[model samples]
Target: MPHFNSAHTQVFQNGELTLGLMTPFGDATHDLADMEDQFRLAAMADELGFKALWVRDVPLMVPQGSANTASNLDDPFIWLAGIAGVTKRIALGTAAAVLTLRNPIHLAKTALSMDRLSKGRFILGLGSGDRPAEFAAFNEDPETRAAVYREHWKLLRSALSSSDEQRSVLRSATGGFDLMSKPASDIPMIVVGTSRQSLQWIAEHADAWATYHREDARQQGRIGLWRLSLEQKGASLNKPFIQSIQLELSSDPDTATEPLELGLRTGRNGLNRYLAGLKTMGVSHVILNLTLKQRNAGEIIEEIGQYVIPRFPP
Candidate 1:
């Protein structure tokens, strides 16, 4: 059965650091994740105490190039539902759910329903859709994501807030329409990347910020630039900062220490060696997904939980 507690709810509230795993395979274009493993691995991640398992919302990965996809390819939500039934505590999240592709009504229902199943453990992150091909499939112009995303984001918030009339815009036209099962709390919405909107808007509206993985030189630059934005916007809350890192944790966490796709292919030890540096560099959480990784994903997870976690236990 699904379990809920203050610890799960507090993943967003303070200086908490969390980890996430992307799907278990790699992509063709841009090398983003395309295929993923069967649900069994994800359930294992849950038992191991991973904060979340992120799935990509890639609709079309360059079309005709489907066969080249690395692993089992299917709709992410299907996988989420399957994983939900098996795991008790882990969160099912997208590195971001591209709001521009999905209909907001359906998405609201899906997220809230998942929260109910997980007993209020859903945390949603979104961004202006990045893949142009995906937006095109929905008959949407890639350039129009900023406007559409802002509207959808606002509408979802209102619909999810109250079970009262007038505030309900999700299902029926009447205001008092309530979503079948609203989430226990304001389901967190973290914006992944900048959408050309004001930093103030993100600060005022976003529950947290999700950013990309950067090497040392670029990492400092990112912290500087984003901190400037936060300072300029006069942001007050201790909004958490989460980034994704692709790693290859082998039997020896020391042997793997070179850059791979968007991340390094370092052994578990090398990965941990750099984490303290990252924490000091102002990253609140790091979701290290060995997805599309070079080594065994399950072995990596165990190694991380048993050996690496003791050093910098989240």
Candidate 2:
């Protein structure tokens, strides 16, 4: 069995739920010309006891819609490295790095470098990627993404593994070349979304699984299916389930939950209750993407740190 690193342990525990924040912090309309303030808020989140900080991967600016506007304009690895420099204890991660577009060897090397820089406080969340334009841009076929994902995933794992047996296998496959550096510690790979693969595949490979927020009934059913898949594979069933929410936090602490496209508009109390319910249903972590239109991101982080996080203590 692989040992859990600091990042994994900080954000995940069996039968408990922790909170995380997405990067590009502050108002959605805020200027991105300067990342200084963003780094400052990230440090504040670390000080305020947020468990992990997540960054997204968007290689291209193909606009999806009004609802899916891309805010993560920077490269995921470089962005997390910067975050690692500013924050002390808060774990850093890619919300979902597009696996099929990049070479597995390069991706693994960058991930290992980030892990070392963060002092074992890095989690790698990977996805197969869905955008057709992105696939075309990379000169990859969208139709073959599933096969590509499985192939690259194996290579990436081999590159990241410290075991001589695994490295030998990789060398044999790659015509005698070797990846020189190894991770400082076991870096947890959280498979984000379905990744165009089966639940069984994810259960067999991923250290954890992350998905976007869904309705309670659907989400619970998904978790049950994940557990069943693990059981079928005869693997440990304690792997965590992570979810992301696009939150528009209301100032009124007791305001009721109103559903948005991918998340909710709720006050601190409502958010706490919702997270408690998710925890009971087997979610291990919730990544909050603040969609604040009125309040400052710092204020909401403080409010959540004071009220919501205590109810689901990390």
Tens digits of per-residue lDDT, candidate 1, 139-161, equal: 88877778888888877765555
For residue 50, model 2's alpha carbon misses the true position, in angstroms, by: 0.9
- Counting clashing residue pairs in each candidate, in order, gives 11, 0
* Per-residue lDDT over 1-314 for candidate 2, one digit per residue giving the tens place of the 0 to 100 score: 87657998899977899999988775433345257878888998999889999988878876575666655377778888888999999999998999989888888879888888889898989999878999998899989989999998888777677666666656866798876666655778889999989999999999998999999999999999999999998889898989999899999998899999899999888898899899999999999999868898889998998888778765
Which ranges of candidate 1 are over 4 A from the true structure?
1-10, 25-37, 63-72, 162-176, 291-294
lDDT per model vs. reference:
0.66, 0.86
RMSD to native for every prediction?
A: 4.6, 1.7
Candidate 1, residue 88: how far the Cα is off, in Å: 1.2
How close to the true structure is residue 95 of candidate 1, measured as C-alpha lDDT? 61
